[model samples]
Target: MNHRQSGSMDSVTIAFELMRLELGAEVDNLNAYGASLFHESQYEEATKLGERGKALRGFLEKVQLLEAEWVNSFAGTAEVDYQDPAVEAATRQILSNSKSPKTALLVRYPCGEVVAEKKGADTLIEVIKRAGAERVAKLGILVNSENIVSRTPSKKYNEARVPPHFIKTHSSTAQKKRNIEQISDALGLGLTVEIIS
Candidate 1:
């Protein structure tokens, strides 16, 4: 399921939680929880429950592919759709495996962009650029306000920063040239500019 269609973050979070709860159940019989939930036309909730099983399975497949790439790398995880049971089950299997490390390099974002199907292949480069930006922010050496999982037409999000004085650095994408130009003009006080593609 396209998670973007999940309506809102609150609903998505709730649905994912329910999906988690359902996947771990060992019995085939419907629990009192299922009866009460499914009878009320809470199909979304029901889907959530079904998805755990699917995510676990997907997770396993991801781990196998990642394992093929590195000898000792921690098993990879599948991102839960929180909408499909088979997908969720696969995700669960991948994430819950004891072999997977706690700090596994889960691909949360590739170049400040998050989508099931990426348009470009420079995500790894994007990740490195993002890391550089974070380090710069830690040092207070640069402004660090680019949205990870960037958007098209680049609508500014209400992003909150921990170090309020820190500046956000943006990557160079021709698509964002106008916004970048505007932003650079706004930072007219001789702020340091770093260009990244």
Candidate 2:
């Protein structure tokens, strides 16, 4: 889980720790190759375990990187700039697959003003539009608000978040809150709202 945060000791090391506890020398040699690769600056190959006894910690990132390379390998090697549009284009392709619909993206920033904000609806709409995902609104949203009790008067409040999508674009908590009234205004609208604290 430390891998979820950016500046941890790197999950690869954590994996080695776990493997050392579980399998001892049967896995000690596995870490040796990764250590050489890490020090030699040959990240991709260095981490390669030949018929290994342990699973990797941050292996998904490696798989993603390798998959990205394999998709582009025929074009000959090019410097992989993560911020490049080619990466974005590939992402769009993944997102647009009709077989799986995903939620519209959500982002949050401290409103920064001293004023209170019931502005989630507007913020969510704008974010979707900016991502060229305005069409996602028709599918509806599921707002997952949490009202944390303040220990001190006017205590810090953490806003709720939209979860990861299992499917291209559908709904999110922000979208739900935005359209709740519209859903209610209609007769026989099959909608329910739940708030968690």
Candidate 3:
């Protein structure tokens, strides 16, 4: 796995590559459509297609730059591996139930207690607060991809008078790191994405 703290292309880099391929195809399609419309003498529709093609071309260029930037940002990242049978079990369980992928935060407090929970709104802070962490020295955060189960509850009950529920859709990993970094910085803690095989 390329989870080491070295500057190398990772999954995000690969995803950007795939995105570029798709965008390139879209741009080609738009150009072909525009040319066809022009041949049919529909000047107004042809102009619209041409403009859309231009916009897609511009966006494709931006994606390339962004991909380069993303690849360059992975210098000396401090990635730690989280090793705990219980935690691993919990993570697997959460992932099995989750409809969408989730990020888990493993928080180690000053009192030598480690808490593993899903990353969400102020989850780290809330854990610290709930743990009653005072006179803090430092905090360590481990981030890893996990599964988050989002259940859709029914307002009305079934024939058995039981409210039924099901899973639904949700939302990314690199962007997740950025968001986690903001919160970790705000809380004055060290953060690292955990390496999982």
Per-candidate TM-score against the hidden true structure: 0.17, 0.19, 0.35
lDDT of 1 by residue, 12-65 (tens): 343443343333222122232433467788988867765753566465445434
Looking at model 2, which ten-residue stretch has the lowest summed lDDT? 146-155
The regions of model 3 sitting more than 4 angstroms off are 1-9, 75-197
Off by over 4 Å in 1: 1-120, 133-197
lDDT of each: 0.33, 0.33, 0.43
For residue 62, model 3's alpha carbon misses the true position, in angstroms, by 1.1
Query: Per-residue lDDT tens digits of candidate 3, residues 68-161?
Result: 6765665224243333456445544543333322334445555566555454323434443453233111232212211111123322111111
* Poorly placed runs, candidate 2 (over 4 Å): 1-59, 77-95, 112-197
Poorest stretch of ten by lDDT in candidate 3? 156-165
What's the distance in Å from true for residue 3, model 3? Answer: 4.7
| lDDT, model 1, position 21 | 30
Best-first order by TM-score: 3, 2, 1
Candidate 2, residue 72: the lDDT equals: 50
> Over the full model, what C-alpha lDDT does candidate 1 score relative to the true structure?
0.33
